[model samples]
Target: MDSSEYILNAHNKEEFPPAHTAEHLLNQLMFRMFGAERSRNAHIERKKSKMTFTLDHKPDRKEEKAIETEMNRLIEEDLPVTSEMVDRDHIPDGVSLEKLPEGASEMIQLVRIGDYDVCPCIGRHVRSTAQIGRFELLGTNWDEHAKSFRVRFKVIP
Candidate 1:
Protein backbone atom coordinates (compact mmCIF):
# COMPACT_ATOMS: atom_id res chain seq x y z
CA MET A 1 0.00 0.00 0.00
CA ASP A 2 1.07 3.56 -0.57
CA SER A 3 2.41 5.22 2.57
CA SER A 4 0.65 8.51 1.92
CA GLU A 5 -2.27 9.95 0.06
CA TYR A 6 -2.48 13.32 -1.68
CA ILE A 7 -5.78 14.76 -0.68
CA LEU A 8 -7.40 18.05 -1.83
CA ASN A 9 -10.15 19.61 0.24
CA ALA A 10 -12.21 21.97 -1.84
CA HIS A 11 -14.74 23.78 0.33
CA ASN A 12 -16.67 24.61 -2.80
CA LYS A 13 -16.00 24.21 -6.50
CA GLU A 14 -15.54 27.99 -6.73
CA GLU A 15 -12.06 27.88 -5.23
CA PHE A 16 -10.25 25.72 -7.76
CA PRO A 17 -11.16 26.19 -11.41
CA PRO A 18 -9.22 29.29 -12.39
CA ALA A 19 -6.06 28.69 -10.40
CA HIS A 20 -5.63 25.12 -11.57
CA THR A 21 -6.18 26.18 -15.15
CA ALA A 22 -3.58 28.92 -14.79
CA GLU A 23 -1.07 26.26 -13.88
CA HIS A 24 -1.31 24.97 -17.43
CA LEU A 25 -0.19 28.29 -18.86
CA LEU A 26 2.66 28.47 -16.39
CA ASN A 27 3.66 24.93 -17.30
CA GLN A 28 3.88 25.78 -20.98
CA LEU A 29 5.87 28.97 -20.41
CA MET A 30 8.36 27.18 -18.16
CA PHE A 31 8.93 24.51 -20.78
CA ARG A 32 9.23 26.95 -23.66
CA MET A 33 11.42 29.43 -21.81
CA PHE A 34 13.54 27.27 -19.54
CA GLY A 35 13.10 23.73 -20.82
CA ALA A 36 11.59 22.79 -17.47
CA GLU A 37 8.99 20.08 -17.03
CA ARG A 38 6.50 19.80 -14.22
CA SER A 39 7.59 16.99 -11.90
CA ARG A 40 4.51 16.89 -9.70
CA ASN A 41 1.35 18.82 -8.88
CA ALA A 42 -0.78 18.82 -5.75
CA HIS A 43 -3.80 21.06 -5.70
CA ILE A 44 -5.28 21.51 -2.26
CA GLU A 45 -8.93 21.90 -1.62
CA ARG A 46 -9.59 24.58 0.99
CA LYS A 47 -10.34 28.24 1.50
CA LYS A 48 -7.42 30.67 1.03
CA SER A 49 -5.95 27.89 -1.07
CA LYS A 50 -2.52 26.76 -2.09
CA MET A 51 -1.22 24.49 -4.88
CA THR A 52 2.36 23.33 -5.20
CA PHE A 53 4.34 21.76 -8.01
CA THR A 54 7.93 21.07 -8.92
CA LEU A 55 9.96 21.56 -12.08
CA ASP A 56 12.77 19.61 -13.70
CA HIS A 57 14.95 22.72 -13.37
CA LYS A 58 14.89 26.00 -11.53
CA PRO A 59 13.94 29.18 -13.36
CA ASP A 60 15.86 32.41 -12.96
CA ARG A 61 14.32 35.67 -11.73
CA LYS A 62 14.09 37.22 -15.18
CA GLU A 63 12.50 34.15 -16.69
CA GLU A 64 10.08 33.89 -13.79
CA LYS A 65 8.98 37.50 -14.26
CA ALA A 66 8.57 36.94 -17.98
CA ILE A 67 6.40 33.96 -17.24
CA GLU A 68 4.22 36.05 -14.94
CA THR A 69 3.89 38.77 -17.54
CA GLU A 70 3.09 36.56 -20.49
CA MET A 71 0.59 34.56 -18.51
CA ASN A 72 -1.26 37.70 -17.47
CA ARG A 73 -1.35 38.92 -21.04
CA LEU A 74 -2.86 35.67 -22.18
CA ILE A 75 -5.41 35.82 -19.39
CA GLU A 76 -6.18 39.40 -20.34
CA GLU A 77 -6.63 38.36 -23.93
CA ASP A 78 -9.38 36.14 -22.54
CA LEU A 79 -8.45 33.38 -24.91
CA PRO A 80 -11.25 30.99 -25.62
CA VAL A 81 -10.71 27.55 -24.16
CA THR A 82 -12.07 24.32 -25.56
CA SER A 83 -11.39 20.59 -25.67
CA GLU A 84 -12.11 17.62 -27.94
CA MET A 85 -11.39 13.95 -28.24
CA VAL A 86 -8.61 12.77 -30.55
CA ASP A 87 -7.62 9.25 -31.44
CA ARG A 88 -4.54 7.95 -29.67
CA ASP A 89 -3.18 6.49 -32.93
CA HIS A 90 -3.69 9.90 -34.55
CA ILE A 91 -1.67 12.78 -33.24
CA PRO A 92 -3.14 15.99 -34.57
CA ASP A 93 -0.96 17.95 -36.97
CA GLY A 94 1.19 20.65 -35.27
CA VAL A 95 -0.12 19.88 -31.79
CA SER A 96 2.51 18.81 -29.27
CA LEU A 97 2.50 16.62 -26.20
CA GLU A 98 4.68 17.83 -23.33
CA LYS A 99 5.04 14.38 -21.80
CA LEU A 100 3.43 11.13 -22.71
CA PRO A 101 1.16 10.22 -19.81
CA GLU A 102 0.61 6.49 -19.39
CA GLY A 103 -2.69 4.59 -19.16
CA ALA A 104 -4.35 6.94 -21.61
CA SER A 105 -7.11 5.27 -23.56
CA GLU A 106 -7.36 5.09 -27.33
CA MET A 107 -8.85 8.58 -27.49
CA ILE A 108 -7.25 11.66 -25.91
CA GLN A 109 -8.82 14.85 -24.66
CA LEU A 110 -7.25 17.94 -26.21
CA VAL A 111 -7.46 21.25 -24.35
CA ARG A 112 -6.54 24.24 -26.48
CA ILE A 113 -6.17 28.01 -26.66
CA GLY A 114 -6.68 29.83 -29.95
CA ASP A 115 -3.00 30.56 -30.73
CA TYR A 116 -1.41 29.59 -27.47
CA ASP A 117 -0.94 26.32 -25.59
CA VAL A 118 -2.21 22.98 -26.88
CA CYS A 119 -1.74 19.62 -25.23
CA PRO A 120 -3.68 16.67 -23.91
CA CYS A 121 -5.25 17.32 -20.49
CA ILE A 122 -8.07 15.93 -18.37
CA GLY A 123 -8.67 18.82 -16.02
CA ARG A 124 -11.21 21.57 -15.46
CA HIS A 125 -10.64 25.03 -16.98
CA VAL A 126 -12.52 28.29 -17.17
CA ARG A 127 -14.70 29.14 -20.15
CA SER A 128 -12.09 31.68 -21.23
CA THR A 129 -8.53 32.28 -20.15
CA ALA A 130 -9.37 35.83 -19.12
CA GLN A 131 -11.62 34.51 -16.44
CA ILE A 132 -8.47 33.73 -14.49
CA GLY A 133 -8.33 37.48 -13.74
CA ARG A 134 -4.63 38.17 -13.18
CA PHE A 135 -1.88 35.71 -12.27
CA GLU A 136 0.15 35.59 -9.11
CA LEU A 137 2.72 32.91 -8.29
CA LEU A 138 3.87 33.28 -4.72
CA GLY A 139 7.27 32.54 -3.16
CA THR A 140 9.39 31.92 -6.23
CA ASN A 141 12.14 29.67 -4.94
CA TRP A 142 13.49 26.42 -6.30
CA ASP A 143 16.40 24.07 -5.63
CA GLU A 144 18.28 23.10 -8.77
CA HIS A 145 19.91 20.02 -7.26
CA ALA A 146 16.72 18.85 -5.64
CA LYS A 147 14.62 19.62 -8.72
CA SER A 148 11.92 21.05 -6.48
CA PHE A 149 9.86 24.24 -6.25
CA ARG A 150 7.00 25.38 -4.09
CA VAL A 151 4.39 27.81 -5.46
CA ARG A 152 1.42 28.92 -3.37
CA PHE A 153 -0.99 31.36 -4.99
CA LYS A 154 -4.63 32.07 -5.60
CA VAL A 155 -6.69 34.00 -8.17
CA ILE A 156 -7.38 37.70 -7.66
CA PRO A 157 -10.93 38.70 -6.93
Candidate 2:
Protein backbone atom coordinates (compact mmCIF):
# COMPACT_ATOMS: atom_id res chain seq x y z
CA MET A 1 0.00 0.00 0.00
CA ASP A 2 1.09 3.59 -0.64
CA SER A 3 2.49 5.53 2.33
CA SER A 4 0.30 8.50 1.48
CA GLU A 5 -2.73 6.58 2.69
CA TYR A 6 -1.43 6.85 6.26
CA ILE A 7 -1.55 10.64 6.36
CA LEU A 8 -4.62 11.81 4.50
CA ASN A 9 -7.58 12.82 6.66
CA ALA A 10 -11.32 13.28 6.12
CA HIS A 11 -10.64 16.81 4.84
CA ASN A 12 -8.91 15.25 1.83
CA LYS A 13 -6.11 17.79 2.19
CA GLU A 14 -2.92 17.00 0.31
CA GLU A 15 -0.23 15.84 2.70
CA PHE A 16 3.11 14.79 1.28
CA PRO A 17 4.06 11.54 2.96
CA PRO A 18 7.79 12.11 2.66
CA ALA A 19 7.64 15.64 3.96
CA HIS A 20 5.59 14.63 6.96
CA THR A 21 7.99 11.88 7.87
CA ALA A 22 11.01 14.06 7.30
CA GLU A 23 9.59 16.59 9.73
CA HIS A 24 9.73 14.00 12.48
CA LEU A 25 13.34 13.16 11.65
CA LEU A 26 14.30 16.82 11.56
CA ASN A 27 12.84 17.43 15.00
CA GLN A 28 15.10 14.81 16.53
CA LEU A 29 18.11 16.22 14.68
CA MET A 30 17.40 19.68 16.00
CA PHE A 31 17.19 18.34 19.53
CA ARG A 32 20.56 16.63 19.19
CA MET A 33 22.25 19.69 17.72
CA PHE A 34 20.92 22.45 19.98
CA GLY A 35 19.57 20.64 23.04
CA ALA A 36 16.42 22.64 22.50
CA GLU A 37 12.84 21.55 22.59
CA ARG A 38 11.21 19.82 19.66
CA SER A 39 9.07 21.91 17.36
CA ARG A 40 6.39 23.76 19.28
CA ASN A 41 4.59 24.79 16.13
CA ALA A 42 4.70 23.21 12.70
CA HIS A 43 2.97 23.82 9.44
CA ILE A 44 3.21 20.56 7.55
CA GLU A 45 2.11 20.87 3.92
CA ARG A 46 2.67 19.37 0.48
CA LYS A 47 4.84 22.14 -0.97
CA LYS A 48 6.92 22.92 2.13
CA SER A 49 6.87 22.77 5.91
CA LYS A 50 7.94 25.00 8.78
CA MET A 51 8.75 24.14 12.42
CA THR A 52 9.37 26.46 15.32
CA PHE A 53 11.81 25.75 18.14
CA THR A 54 12.48 27.77 21.24
CA LEU A 55 16.18 28.55 21.55
CA ASP A 56 18.45 30.95 23.35
CA HIS A 57 20.12 32.06 20.12
CA LYS A 58 19.67 31.60 16.40
CA PRO A 59 21.55 28.98 14.45
CA ASP A 60 24.26 30.24 12.09
CA ARG A 61 24.66 29.40 8.42
CA LYS A 62 27.10 26.57 9.11
CA GLU A 63 24.70 25.00 11.58
CA GLU A 64 21.83 25.36 9.14
CA LYS A 65 23.85 23.62 6.45
CA ALA A 66 24.73 20.87 8.87
CA ILE A 67 21.05 20.31 9.61
CA GLU A 68 20.34 19.86 5.90
CA THR A 69 23.33 17.61 5.40
CA GLU A 70 22.53 15.36 8.36
CA MET A 71 18.93 14.94 7.31
CA ASN A 72 19.99 13.96 3.81
CA ARG A 73 22.55 11.53 5.17
CA LEU A 74 19.92 9.83 7.29
CA ILE A 75 17.53 9.73 4.37
CA GLU A 76 20.17 8.07 2.24
CA GLU A 77 20.67 5.46 4.96
CA ASP A 78 17.46 3.75 3.85
CA LEU A 79 16.18 3.22 7.35
CA PRO A 80 12.81 1.56 7.67
CA VAL A 81 9.90 3.83 8.61
CA THR A 82 7.80 1.73 10.93
CA SER A 83 4.98 2.33 13.35
CA GLU A 84 3.16 0.45 16.11
CA MET A 85 0.39 1.19 18.53
CA VAL A 86 1.38 0.94 22.19
CA ASP A 87 -0.33 1.60 25.45
CA ARG A 88 0.54 4.98 26.90
CA ASP A 89 2.04 3.29 29.96
CA HIS A 90 4.67 1.66 27.74
CA ILE A 91 5.73 4.94 26.19
CA PRO A 92 9.48 5.08 26.53
CA ASP A 93 11.40 7.71 28.34
CA GLY A 94 12.79 10.70 26.37
CA VAL A 95 9.89 10.58 23.94
CA SER A 96 8.13 13.87 24.47
CA LEU A 97 4.35 14.06 24.64
CA GLU A 98 4.23 17.81 24.07
CA LYS A 99 3.23 17.48 20.44
CA LEU A 100 0.27 15.31 21.15
CA PRO A 101 -3.03 17.15 21.06
CA GLU A 102 -5.32 17.49 24.06
CA GLY A 103 -7.32 14.42 25.06
CA ALA A 104 -5.15 12.16 22.95
CA SER A 105 -5.85 8.48 23.40
CA GLU A 106 -4.06 6.23 25.86
CA MET A 107 -3.04 4.04 22.99
CA ILE A 108 -0.35 5.98 21.11
CA GLN A 109 1.12 5.27 17.73
CA LEU A 110 4.91 5.27 17.78
CA VAL A 111 6.98 6.04 14.69
CA ARG A 112 10.64 5.14 14.56
CA ILE A 113 13.38 5.99 12.07
CA GLY A 114 15.78 3.09 12.25
CA ASP A 115 17.79 3.45 15.47
CA TYR A 116 17.84 7.20 15.11
CA ASP A 117 14.50 8.50 16.37
CA VAL A 118 11.28 7.43 18.00
CA CYS A 119 8.25 9.58 18.67
CA PRO A 120 4.53 9.27 19.16
CA CYS A 121 2.96 10.31 15.90
CA ILE A 122 -0.30 9.66 14.11
CA GLY A 123 0.77 11.09 10.73
CA ARG A 124 1.60 9.19 7.54
CA HIS A 125 5.13 8.33 6.48
CA VAL A 126 7.00 6.54 3.71
CA ARG A 127 7.99 2.92 4.14
CA SER A 128 11.67 3.80 4.30
CA THR A 129 14.04 6.72 4.66
CA ALA A 130 15.27 6.39 1.09
CA GLN A 131 11.82 7.47 -0.01
CA ILE A 132 12.50 10.80 1.71
CA GLY A 133 15.17 11.62 -0.88
CA ARG A 134 16.90 14.90 0.04
CA PHE A 135 16.14 17.59 2.57
CA GLU A 136 16.49 21.33 1.87
CA LEU A 137 16.54 24.27 4.20
CA LEU A 138 14.68 27.11 2.56
CA GLY A 139 15.09 29.78 5.23
CA THR A 140 14.86 30.63 8.95
CA ASN A 141 13.32 33.23 11.16
CA TRP A 142 13.78 34.13 14.84
CA ASP A 143 11.22 35.79 17.04
CA GLU A 144 12.96 37.74 19.78
CA HIS A 145 9.94 38.21 21.94
CA ALA A 146 8.83 34.62 21.77
CA LYS A 147 12.39 33.27 21.84
CA SER A 148 11.43 30.98 19.05
CA PHE A 149 13.46 29.92 16.02
CA ARG A 150 11.52 28.95 12.95
CA VAL A 151 12.89 26.88 10.09
CA ARG A 152 11.32 26.33 6.70
CA PHE A 153 12.21 23.28 4.65
CA LYS A 154 11.21 20.95 1.81
CA VAL A 155 11.91 17.39 0.72
CA ILE A 156 13.16 16.84 -2.81
CA PRO A 157 12.62 13.74 -4.86
Candidate 3:
Protein backbone atom coordinates (compact mmCIF):
# COMPACT_ATOMS: atom_id res chain seq x y z
CA MET A 1 0.00 0.00 0.00
CA ASP A 2 3.11 2.21 0.02
CA SER A 3 2.44 3.20 3.67
CA SER A 4 -0.27 5.82 3.05
CA GLU A 5 -3.18 5.62 5.48
CA TYR A 6 -6.26 3.72 4.32
CA ILE A 7 -9.77 4.04 5.75
CA LEU A 8 -13.32 2.78 5.11
CA ASN A 9 -16.40 4.77 4.20
CA ALA A 10 -18.72 5.37 7.12
CA HIS A 11 -21.68 4.16 5.06
CA ASN A 12 -22.30 0.82 3.45
CA LYS A 13 -21.95 0.02 -0.27
CA GLU A 14 -24.87 2.01 -1.66
CA GLU A 15 -24.13 5.28 0.13
CA PHE A 16 -20.40 5.00 -0.16
CA PRO A 17 -20.31 4.42 -3.92
CA PRO A 18 -21.97 7.70 -4.87
CA ALA A 19 -20.22 9.72 -2.19
CA HIS A 20 -16.85 8.22 -2.95
CA THR A 21 -17.39 8.67 -6.68
CA ALA A 22 -18.23 12.30 -6.05
CA GLU A 23 -14.98 12.62 -4.15
CA HIS A 24 -13.10 11.19 -7.10
CA LEU A 25 -14.86 13.64 -9.42
CA LEU A 26 -13.91 16.42 -7.04
CA ASN A 27 -10.33 15.26 -7.19
CA GLN A 28 -10.42 15.38 -10.97
CA LEU A 29 -12.24 18.71 -11.06
CA MET A 30 -9.69 20.39 -8.85
CA PHE A 31 -6.95 19.21 -11.11
CA ARG A 32 -8.70 20.59 -14.18
CA MET A 33 -9.67 23.90 -12.55
CA PHE A 34 -6.13 24.40 -11.43
CA GLY A 35 -2.83 22.89 -12.41
CA ALA A 36 -2.51 21.36 -8.95
CA GLU A 37 -2.86 17.62 -8.45
CA ARG A 38 -4.31 15.52 -5.62
CA SER A 39 -2.27 13.60 -3.10
CA ARG A 40 -1.55 9.96 -3.75
CA ASN A 41 -2.43 9.20 -0.12
CA ALA A 42 -5.97 10.45 -0.69
CA HIS A 43 -8.98 8.79 0.98
CA ILE A 44 -12.71 9.24 1.54
CA GLU A 45 -13.80 8.35 5.07
CA ARG A 46 -17.32 7.00 4.73
CA LYS A 47 -17.45 6.15 8.42
CA LYS A 48 -16.39 9.66 9.34
CA SER A 49 -18.91 10.74 6.69
CA LYS A 50 -16.46 13.35 5.40
CA MET A 51 -14.54 13.77 2.16
CA THR A 52 -11.14 15.45 1.97
CA PHE A 53 -8.06 15.73 -0.26
CA THR A 54 -4.53 17.10 -0.05
CA LEU A 55 -3.76 19.58 -2.83
CA ASP A 56 -0.74 21.63 -3.88
CA HIS A 57 -2.67 24.93 -3.91
CA LYS A 58 -5.65 26.40 -2.11
CA PRO A 59 -8.37 27.89 -4.30
CA ASP A 60 -9.63 31.27 -3.24
CA ARG A 61 -13.39 31.83 -2.92
CA LYS A 62 -13.65 32.54 -6.63
CA GLU A 63 -11.84 29.39 -7.59
CA GLU A 64 -13.86 27.32 -5.17
CA LYS A 65 -17.02 28.80 -6.59
CA ALA A 66 -15.96 27.93 -10.10
CA ILE A 67 -15.07 24.43 -8.94
CA GLU A 68 -18.39 24.02 -7.18
CA THR A 69 -20.13 25.04 -10.36
CA GLU A 70 -18.12 22.66 -12.47
CA MET A 71 -18.56 19.77 -10.08
CA ASN A 72 -22.28 20.21 -9.68
CA ARG A 73 -22.60 20.50 -13.43
CA LEU A 74 -20.86 17.20 -13.77
CA ILE A 75 -23.26 15.52 -11.35
CA GLU A 76 -26.33 17.10 -12.87
CA GLU A 77 -25.22 16.24 -16.36
CA ASP A 78 -24.99 12.72 -15.02
CA LEU A 79 -22.65 11.70 -17.78
CA PRO A 80 -22.52 7.99 -18.27
CA VAL A 81 -20.04 6.62 -15.78
CA THR A 82 -18.67 3.38 -17.12
CA SER A 83 -15.89 0.94 -16.43
CA GLU A 84 -14.34 -2.16 -17.99
CA MET A 85 -11.43 -4.53 -17.85
CA VAL A 86 -8.08 -3.45 -19.22
CA ASP A 87 -4.71 -5.10 -19.31
CA ARG A 88 -2.21 -3.69 -16.82
CA ASP A 89 0.02 -2.91 -19.76
CA HIS A 90 -2.70 -0.73 -21.38
CA ILE A 91 -2.76 1.84 -18.57
CA PRO A 92 -2.24 5.32 -20.02
CA ASP A 93 1.18 6.90 -19.88
CA GLY A 94 0.62 9.63 -17.25
CA VAL A 95 -1.79 7.81 -14.93
CA SER A 96 -0.47 6.14 -11.78
CA LEU A 97 -1.34 2.54 -10.95
CA GLU A 98 0.97 2.01 -8.03
CA LYS A 99 -1.67 1.80 -5.27
CA LEU A 100 -4.58 -0.51 -5.94
CA PRO A 101 -6.08 -0.75 -2.47
CA GLU A 102 -7.60 -3.98 -1.09
CA GLY A 103 -10.18 -5.47 -3.53
CA ALA A 104 -8.72 -4.01 -6.71
CA SER A 105 -7.45 -6.93 -8.73
CA GLU A 106 -4.52 -6.99 -11.15
CA MET A 107 -6.94 -6.85 -14.12
CA ILE A 108 -7.70 -3.22 -13.17
CA GLN A 109 -10.94 -1.33 -13.62
CA LEU A 110 -11.05 2.26 -14.82
CA VAL A 111 -13.85 4.82 -14.38
CA ARG A 112 -14.80 7.51 -16.88
CA ILE A 113 -17.04 10.53 -16.33
CA GLY A 114 -18.71 11.39 -19.60
CA ASP A 115 -15.77 11.78 -21.93
CA TYR A 116 -14.02 14.23 -19.68
CA ASP A 117 -12.89 12.34 -16.57
CA VAL A 118 -10.85 9.18 -17.04
CA CYS A 119 -8.54 7.50 -14.58
CA PRO A 120 -7.73 4.22 -12.91
CA CYS A 121 -10.09 3.62 -9.97
CA ILE A 122 -11.22 0.76 -7.74
CA GLY A 123 -14.01 2.67 -5.97
CA ARG A 124 -17.68 2.43 -6.94
CA HIS A 125 -19.54 5.34 -8.57
CA VAL A 126 -22.87 6.15 -10.17
CA ARG A 127 -23.40 4.42 -13.51
CA SER A 128 -24.08 7.79 -15.06
CA THR A 129 -23.90 11.45 -14.08
CA ALA A 130 -27.65 11.57 -13.54
CA GLN A 131 -27.34 9.26 -10.56
CA ILE A 132 -24.86 11.68 -8.98
CA GLY A 133 -27.83 13.84 -7.98
CA ARG A 134 -27.02 17.35 -6.77
CA PHE A 135 -23.77 18.53 -5.28
CA GLU A 136 -22.80 21.46 -3.09
CA LEU A 137 -19.44 22.86 -2.09
CA LEU A 138 -19.60 22.59 1.67
CA GLY A 139 -16.26 24.37 2.29
CA THR A 140 -12.49 24.42 1.77
CA ASN A 141 -9.33 25.69 3.47
CA TRP A 142 -5.57 25.76 3.19
CA ASP A 143 -3.71 23.46 5.50
CA GLU A 144 -0.59 24.14 7.64
CA HIS A 145 1.89 25.15 4.94
CA ALA A 146 -0.36 26.43 2.15
CA LYS A 147 1.26 23.53 0.37
CA SER A 148 -2.06 21.71 0.65
CA PHE A 149 -5.71 22.64 0.47
CA ARG A 150 -8.42 20.53 2.08
CA VAL A 151 -11.92 20.52 0.55
CA ARG A 152 -15.05 19.18 2.24
CA PHE A 153 -18.25 18.77 0.25
CA LYS A 154 -21.18 16.47 -0.51
CA VAL A 155 -23.66 15.30 -3.11
CA ILE A 156 -27.41 15.39 -2.55
CA PRO A 157 -29.25 12.59 -4.24
RMSD of each: 7.9, 3.7, 6.6
Scanning candidate 2 in windows of ten residues, the lowest lDDT window is: 1-10
Error of 1 at 40 (Å): 2.7
Please provide TM-scores, in order, for all candidate models, with all chains considered together: 0.71, 0.87, 0.76
Clashing pairs in 2: none
List the candidate 3 regions with Cα displacement exceeding 4 Å.
Answer: 1-15, 41-56, 101-104, 144-146
Q: Candidate 1 — number of clashing residue pairs? A: 2
Superposed Cα deviation of residue 1, candidate 2 (Å): 16
Model 2 Cα shift for residue 78 (angstroms): 1.1
- How much does candidate 2 score in TM-score? 0.87
- For residues 3-43, could you state the per-residue lDDT of candidate 2 as single tens digits? 34344213335568899889888889988999877787889
> Candidate 1 lDDT, tens digit per residue, 37-94?
6535556332333434456666678766777788788889988878777665677775
Off by over 4 Å in 1: 1-15, 44-58, 93-102
Which model scores highest in lDDT? 2
Decoy 3 TM-score against native:
0.76
